[model samples]
Target: MQVCNVCREQTPKYKCPTCKIRYCSVGCYKKHKDSCLPVQPPEPSGPEVKPASSSAVCTDPWSVEDLLNEDDIIDKVPVEKLQLLGRSDQLRDLLRNPHLRQLLRSVDAADSKEDAMKAAMQEPLFVEFSDCCLNIVEDGTAPTHT
Candidate 1:
């Protein structure tokens, strides 16, 4: 039994002529051709040549720390960490955090920003109070009948 190249299912066939991979079915062969990375010829591996320095006579290779650059700070601290320092108005920072973005979007109302924010905070309080009253009435936790 031949195995599918894409999904690894068993079938009667063994070869895919289009992608040149062993496939169990036409579907497997087609899927492989659609998404596989293009095969490239292997390049000969050799030691890289370094440019001759005229003035510097140091004989040792410099560590990554020696290559300290402005870009290095960004590479060191992830984008998520930098976002922590950004203001609320920074959309780049907000969008990067889906939870934050969702919270903001959920709060946005047609009225003024202040009103929208106040309303957003009130929703949880309202739900909590409603649930407490409901449970008390349903479970006879409170003396309600008169």
Candidate 2:
């Protein structure tokens, strides 16, 4: 699954027509247009380029899934490591993780960034996850996948 070209949050459900890259929202789309990168074509596995059969063409209207890019995870200059954290499932197995969920909920509930961030720091799971994330950085190791 591909992440948003800008925020790298949810799986992309929209594509910018100009660049044909997937972005999650109108805000992200706006942010992306100015810094769009060149498209990368799939590598050729054999000697020559081949033509697609006529059956490959579709007449159906585009849907959200049509915007799904098969590029796996994103790690580009514009996307932050903090935004990449939720996209990674390295802490999904931590029990009592609902507090982290609450932290996320509180971000929407709280009136300001300081309040939401303070609430996150108070979450046991978030604290533990932070320790793990930092440890990975300190040790120069990739985050463990579950």
Candidate 3:
């Protein structure tokens, strides 16, 4: 779990828009906002260089890879597949449901994520949401469920 950069206590619930520093609460966010500096994008090196292998180094400072272990990297989905989730109308519609969103939030905030996921799986709406994401990512198509 990622601790708040401000308090270094609780798990962070939100990220600063400018610097992308994680903060747990509104108070922490308010405290951080005053001192937050916008992160500068990295400058490209002279020539266009390509990695010899598919295992290229991740340059983004705040990438999801930063949260993952080396073993997890092996099962990580490609950016192209993840991008398909955003274009999925089925996923957008599923996300519009407050109950599904709450279930997702509960799962995210749970101390035991595995247990939380198992509980969430019992909910039909949550299952549908999971299926929609899988359909989009795996097939690169929105679910045709009616």
Candidate 4:
């Protein structure tokens, strides 16, 4: 069964034509449509202008870490590390892994945050996801630490 991309609930009823995110309900689709636009690279207008240095890189305007600073109890994971999870292809692929689905169920069922984290880290996909995030940060694309 297809999972709703909005809430991760099973059996999404519709998929967005533009971004392809599957949604379970009309409300979810409407709520998510605005932000679900694709992240396409800007097209060149005329003759392409090249940057002086190949070292220049694209980066997110805001740090995900900064967004998490307001929550303490749930923010035990450092922003630096947490920031990496959503930036990589590895984590994207891991989402479809059946083993990860089980791991996530175990994580959500854990009584404590520590226990959830421990169980999540034990899964190979989580480890790979963490590594992918680290790679993104090291690649100079993530916003600089404050």
After aligning candidate 3 to the native by TM-score, how far in Å is the CA of 105 from where it should be? 0.6
lDDT of 2 at 14: 67
TM per candidate comes to 0.23, 0.32, 0.50, 0.34
lDDT of candidate 4 over 1-146, digit per residue (tens): 55678888656655565565667788888889879786464788899877788766424232354334332232245556556656545556766788877777776556564678886887678887566556665663543233
lDDT of 2: 0.62
Across residues 1-146, which tens digit of lDDT does each residue of candidate 1 receive?
Answer: 44556787664243433334556566776667777654453575887655688554443333343444332332244445444333233323334666544556765423355566666456654344335434443443332323
Q: Tell me the lDDT of model 4 at 119.
A: 69
Residue-wise C-alpha lDDT for candidate 2, range 1-146, written one tens digit per residue: 67787898878766665457777877897888789765675788889844597776553334345434345244222235444444445655553467666666776556565567776888677788778666544444446565
Clashes of 1: 0
Q: Model 4: clashing residue pairs?
A: none
Winner on lDDT between 1 and 4 is 4
**Could you say which candidate leads in TM-score?**
3
The TM-score, computed over Cα atoms with residue i paired to residue i, of candidate 4 is 0.34
Model 3 agreement with the true structure over 36-85: per-residue lDDT tens digits = 99989689878879888776654434456335534332346778999888
Model 4 spans with C-alpha error above 4 angstroms: 1-87, 137-146
TM-score of the candidate numbered 3? 0.50
For all candidates in order, the CA lDDT equals 0.47, 0.62, 0.77, 0.63
Query: Which candidate should be chosen as best, given lDDT against the real structure?
Result: 3
Query: By TM-score, highest first, what's the ranking?
Result: 3, 4, 2, 1
- Candidate 3 achieves a global lDDT of 0.77
RMSD of 3: 12.9
